[model samples]
Target: DKKVVLITGCSSGIGLSLAVRLASDPNKTFKVYATMRNLAKKERLLESVKGLHKDTLDILQMDVTDRQSILDARDRVVEKRVDILVCNAGVGLMGPLELQSLDTMRQILEVNLFGTIQTIQAFLPEMKAQGQGRILVTGSTGGLHGLPFNEVYCASKFAIEGACESLAVLLQHFNIHVSLIECGPVNTDFLVNLQKVELGDTSLEQLDTHTLGLYEKYLQHCDSVFQNAAQDTEDIVKVFLDAIQSPSPLFRYFTSGVVPPLTQLKITQPDGSQCIRSMSKIIFSSEEK
Candidate 1:
């Protein structure tokens, strides 16, 4: 039987690349379902692989926030069990924490965390019955560390990490694998789209006047750092492929070069207080100099 893989957020970035790669692999027989929130935006994605591998790729509509949509998509494949499930749909919300509304927080969590879980739940019964399947959730470096202006996005990723951790344990007995891919900033439209949000006058209102003044001075500096930290989306897609195919896959894989050292530092450091003290001194000293 040919293996079937389902991936969300297939319109761009890592998800797009993964769909193309899996469909192109001749050694393995696969049916790749590349799903997106809006199918209309996927024409370029479809065109990119038009003549290359026509039979393997199928574009489907899936919005993580909508239960009915997930069920409908599941119904299409309910008879054909999914060999690998990639929960990759996500969104980014950035700004001063106080300026972020409760609705924004809810929406992020709904899409990034709850949506992934719902997809898993929707597919898990069939996978469990088969006694074999792999589940991969796209987490983030932000999941492991908190960063400025990304509180809501980070919170949602953190929730994903925690949920997947428990899920891995719970599914161990069934021979169903669950892995979290903790990725870094990729070269994608994520950052560009994030900048387009209308912050309004309240963007500055959320901060203390003095803090806002300081932020204005450092905003350019921060943006420069973020722009330079970009990694190739294909690198993340490769990691996802390895996680799916490896005989003994890890429970979690970090795709960014910086994540390993950061993970080590978090473990070796005694507590959050010490880590904060160290980070504060480094950041302040650099600014002062």
Candidate 2:
């Protein structure tokens, strides 16, 4: 029996890569329902998954932020049963806290935090009845190690971490596996999606020079880090495969390189001050620090 795998946010990035990889599997182990918010944006996904076993893949419209959309997509799946559910649909928000609007923050929470919870809630009961399932969330290292100017984004991911942790223990009773893929900078459209609050924003008009200066430095630091260490979309897809195939999946899968040390700061130091100082230094020059 082919595992019925449903993934959200397949318009681009990790979601698209994972959907294509699984659908095109030579062994045809997975029957994939690759979903995105808009069907029009699915051209890239369509092109990429072409020539695969036709019956193995189906693209659907699902907006994680919209309850009705998710329900509609779920109903379309055969038997209303999902063997594997990947909550990969998320939006990114970045900028100075004050400069960011309340609406933007709420939208971020809506799409990234509540949106994920809603998707799981919609499908969890069926999994409970089936007595077996896997939930893989596309979490971020930002959830583990907070970064300057990314407070809103970090808040959303951190909440997800807590939710997934709580669910992991409870789901174990039903033989359901849950994992959070705590990825670092992946070379994806994610960066483009980040609301560069400082860029082309009239709101930054009132911010002081010192604050804007820090933002400029933050942007440069971010660029340098991503340029030097960002992983490919395929790299993350491989990790996703490992988690899906494992009989006993771990709770978290972090992208390789820089994240481990950063995420371990609290455990290693016990005091939060070291992590604070480290991030501060990275975001600002030594003199500014």
Candidate 3:
């Protein structure tokens, strides 16, 4: 029997790479429903799978924020019985928290948190009926700890971490598995595509104008010290594969080399305060040099 997989946010980056990799496997019978917000933007996705096996990859339209799109996608794949569901669609918001708009925060939470919940709701019952399935979510290193200029993005991912943790317990009885992939900074267009939301009349701007100055100084320093810190997309894809295939997969898989050390420090260090303190010193101390 062929396993059916549905992945959201397949227009580019890790989602696109995963879809391509899965399609290349000849032994494992797969029908991959690669989904994105806009079908037109998936030219690259289409092009990547062009020469490979026919009918193995199907590109579908899905906007995580819209219920209608989710329902439509569900209808298309309802017959196949999805064996795996990858909630990979997410947006990043960069800049000081004080400079962020309420709308921006809402949008991030909507897509990264509520959107993931909706996806689980729409698909979990089907998986339960089938008796076995896997759910992989793209969490971030930021979800493990806070980062400057990415409070909203981190908050949304943090929510995902919590949601998936609870989901693991809730779905265990049904023989379904839920896992979170805490990926590091991969060389992707994720940062480039962040949506800019205008902050309305508020004290946030005044606070941002002050903090932005500090952040600008720190960013310049971090950029120099962390020039070689980016992770490869292929490495992340390998971790995703492991998570999906493991006989007894962990509740959380931290994909980056950096994340494990940081997570350990957070756990072992006394009071759990030194982790952030150390990170802050490394991140902001360059300004002094």
Compare the candidates by TM-score and give the number of the best one: 2
| lDDT for each residue of candidate 3 in 64-99, tens digit (9 for 90 to 100) | 999889989989984558898999999988766656
Rate residue 252 of model 1 by lDDT.
85
lDDT of 1 at 263: 56
Per-candidate TM-scores read 0.90, 0.97, 0.90
Q: Write the per-residue lDDT of candidate 1 for residues 157-239, one digit (tens) a residue.
A: 88888889998998998899999888877886676555313334656765787556545444554466568866788888888
All predictions: root-mean-square deviation over Cα?
A: 2.5, 1.3, 3.1
Candidate 2 wrong stretches, greater than 4 Å: 257-259
Candidate 1 worst ten-residue window by lDDT: 280-289
Sequence-dependent TM-score of model 3: 0.90
Question: How accurate locally, in lDDT, is each candidate?
Answer: 0.78, 0.90, 0.81
Best candidate (score: lDDT)? 2
Candidate 1, position 223, lDDT: 63
Cα error of candidate 1 at position 226, Å: 4.0
